[model samples]
Target chain A: MKKYTYTDKKDTRSGFGAGILELGRTNPNVVALTADLAGSLKLEGFIKEFPDRFIQCGISEANMIGVSAGLTIGGKIPFATTFANFATGRVYDQIRQSVAYSGKNVKICASHAGLTLGEDGATHQILEDLGMMKMLPNMTVITPCDYNQTKAATIAIADYQGPVYLRFGRPVIPIFTPADQKFEIGKALMLNEGPDVSIFATGHLVWEAIQAGEKLAEEGIEAEIINIHTIKPLDEEAILTSVRKTRCAVSAEEHQLNGGLGDSIAQTLARNYPAPLEMIGVHDSFGESGTPAQLMQKYGLTADKIVEAAKRAMERRV
Target chain B: METQQLEQIAVQVRRDILRMVHAVNSGHPGGSLGCTDLFVALYFDVLRLKRDDQGKVIFDMDGRDEDLFFLSNGHISPVWYSVLARAGYFPVSELSTFRKIDSRLQGHPATAEHLPGIRIASGSLGQGLSAACGAALAKRLNGDDKHVYVLMGDGEQQEGQVWEAASFAPHHKLGNLTAIIDLNHQQIDGPTDLVMNNRDLGEKYRAFGWNVTDMKGNDLADVLRTLHESKNDSEVPTLILMHTEMGYGVDFMMGSHKWHGVAPNDEQLATALNQLPITISDLKDY
Candidate 1:
């Protein structure tokens, strides 16, 4: 197993904020609209520096989405920012009709995704966003692993036209990926190469997969770790390629097992490559009040959970 | 175009709407007929369109320097399609394809087919105003003085998104925008007043910091005057409360919510077309 270390720990939302600020300095058409989560989304620097480009949409997520769709008509790329719950479930129709259906160049940036939203409880933690966004035609759903990758993904989606749902998080996590990593939409990034089991993970769960790979090495288990940032245009080729060699798979994400990264990978495998699989995620349940660390353990989204799933998948291999 | 010419266009447009809905056995002929004159006024006279060297209307997705129109209440697409076709955005013959399979003339207006003149897709109500506000903001950012117009149903104001947009445009001072609410007082279920009392609609917008104006939407001259007067790049947005009939030309379909989304039958279509005159640019030629 390859050794990975991080000196800096930052919330994925900060990467979004940094990416927008950097893009603000570079791209003139980069406009930011927030539904009163400017501070939480870490958009202060972008707002302060490029005040003219920032639209304060108050608490109206629906209007924010509509406006973002509208902004694209005048050659402006709009990034509508809000919490994951408000960004997806609350303003779904607005996004469906205006952004996705209309094929508008709008970035639906969501922070505080999954149980890690913590303390705010299950209402704020959105587990169904990936499915909701992925199902919409002309929509690109990207949930990057860490701060650097999130930042790179944010900058990259600006270049790609059409609707995009960029899901990030609130809690600070280790920044393991390179600061200058070139983020490619719909392309899988291989974190580690092993022979026993292929572990496909997304968002915060990618780091857990990496940690699980280290643990599996101690028990003479070689685990292959693959990072799936783009969930909609699922890199089926990568999953097929890695799984064909490993012959078994374990999928992990900070989302529901029913519709998250696991379900997507499962469908891909069922269609193209049939293999033994174990999915690690919230099993048709809601979250509760707990710290980010406590929630991960309670919800089975930790390194140990990934290791367990990987072992289960390997045992089921035919 | 003169007021008389605009009136002729309105008659042809109403005829087009009837024929379109009649052919498909589906479409909203009532609101389409009701909004015919307003559509004629905007497409023919008021909207500052961009054209090619051949005098053809050039449809650009990024309608930066052109006056953009968004139909938020998209069920009335028949009227808009008729007007757009007659104004040379597309061929007037294509109006026959309304609600047909693989036609750019969708049941509701959409940009998915790369249709000329439509910049946004709208059928679900109360969304267009927010989009218009966004385009207006982008125009303001780009230093473009062109205006954006969006039309919504009276019943659509019942949507919370409408009020949110009403509050938004004013707060952002989107003077480059004008939102028109069809004051026909009818929706899908029943009268807007009966379904959801949008009590004092003008008063609500006024309190939301809009410069509200009333216009006779069925009258071409009045629609022209109001649209021209409302064109501004001010700090305040304008709201035109367009008073129109549910079905203006067709007497039987007039003033009833029942005709809102229903297409005109054979005899009904003949009777409705009889009420409107055939213009110089005949629909048959297309």
Candidate 2:
């Protein structure tokens, strides 16, 4: 929990691809469908190894979601793979009617989520997918932190008997979470426990939270960093337990502040136990074409921002 | 079992559709009446669904190893719900609870209500065909030769997702799926041509690489023949464009798009019931 380090850095999408290949070997019922982004989503290994199990859905994301919903009827677990924009907002009605409302066990594995999908501009970079998917009934929204956690979460959701939105990114972030860690759906991973402030981070921001935690530790602020992988079935208890001890909280994510991880934590705190909170994310602006690192800094989704927000939240602590 | 018997059941299903809509005053009767014969022909005779040891249809969400049907143009819940009950998917008496609060018979066909025959929710148009394509692909993967069927309205063709699915089925060679479009030429707005004309839908499907078939939707014998022809064309997915009048059975409502989503008043309901002669008596009337 002190200082975290990574031996390698890889894109989380590759972990999704690796996870698909693993499912191809183990679960006969698992099938992968992609909207012509197999290469971007890193699904070549699964496609080559289990060609029969892979479906190339062309550029039709709506049909892919509907098809994924249908595959569940005949006892096949379908992972409908696409970019975050095409996966959630584009085919939201298809997901709502067929997957979520119908209670079909389809895993909507989305790659290139958030501002971290560098240089594609705002059209390809989807910041509202988490909120869109989470608002639907029977939808499990997940944003795993690293490659290992993304891979683990990919395999873990197939066992769940409902629809899931597993959001990952194209950027090569650090692989800090253990490769052999058993992925729990709603359980938050306590990366670092402290009493000063609670830093709840998800997706790409989890690594940034650790960076901020170290910097805060040098300033004599022991920040509690908890990785909130599952955003919809949020580990409310973990949030409460951490925030109750710290008396203040800061939520970080590579998304909008309005409906991202921060809003989930805000609502939980407001209902169960009121606490001073600061949110670190994009403040209602579309991301432009830029490097992932540049975009993170520009959108206020970096470690310095988290540290700044943490200090602000600590200042407002009663 | 016989065409005559199927017609007898169709008459009662029509009565149920009219009465169900009349009771609720908030259901689609035009499309429901239009697709009555097709629904009866499929559920009562054509579909090869899984039966128990004693021949009772086993109703499960994951209907593996059996034929599956998904209704995409689900505004016609009256027709589907009545047919399912008449097919013994649920008690016919429960049909009385159609559109009532907390009843399983929702305004649209939804799996959330745990309805026996419905595999997925559909009311928002243009999604069912893709689901059928997926189910057909699943059948191919599982090595189960059982079929997947889906029904869509003609006006529902305006949805771009339908074309996405239309292109997919033949491209993937989903021969195990049969997609039927009720060519009622009517949506909630008005005539489909007046709304947005989809010129030659069968030609469009054929261009999309489907084995296109034309069926007289209201005609029971033609519906059965189309089903047989479609069931045999298992190398490429078949699209049966079922040309039907908007309101087929009732003399006054026949061929009118005005009844597309409007429930009949008391007088109109009585008039519609008078035109339909019930012959299937073994099933309880809702």
Distance from true location, Cα of B178 in model 1, Å:
1.0
For candidate 2 chain A, the 10 contiguous residues with the lowest summed lDDT are: A1-10
Q: For every candidate, what is the interface RMSD in angstroms?
A: 0.5, 0.7
lDDT of 2 by residue, B231-282 (tens): 7766799999999998889988888888988989999988888888777652
Q: What is each predicted model's overall lDDT from 0 to 1? A: 0.92, 0.91
Tens digit of lDDT per residue, candidate 2, span A211-291? Answer: 999999999999999999999899999999998899999999988887889999999999999999999988998999999
Listed in order, the DockQ scores are 0.89, 0.89
Once fitted onto the true fold, the runs of candidate 1 whose alpha carbons sit more than 4 angstroms away are none
Q: Could you give candidate 1's per-residue lDDT for residues B1-286 as a string of tens digits?
A: 9999888878888888888888878989888888888888888889889988997788889987889899999999999998998889899888877898989999999989988989899999889999999999989999999999999989889889999999999999988899999999998899888899989999999999999999999888889889999985488999999999999988899999999988878898888777776885556632
Residue-level error in angstroms, candidate 1, position B278: 1.2
Q: Model 1: how far is A8 from its true place, Å?
A: 1.3
- Cα lDDT of model 1 by residue, A255-304, tens digit: 99888899999999999989999999999999999999999999899999
Candidate 1 clash figure, as a count: 0
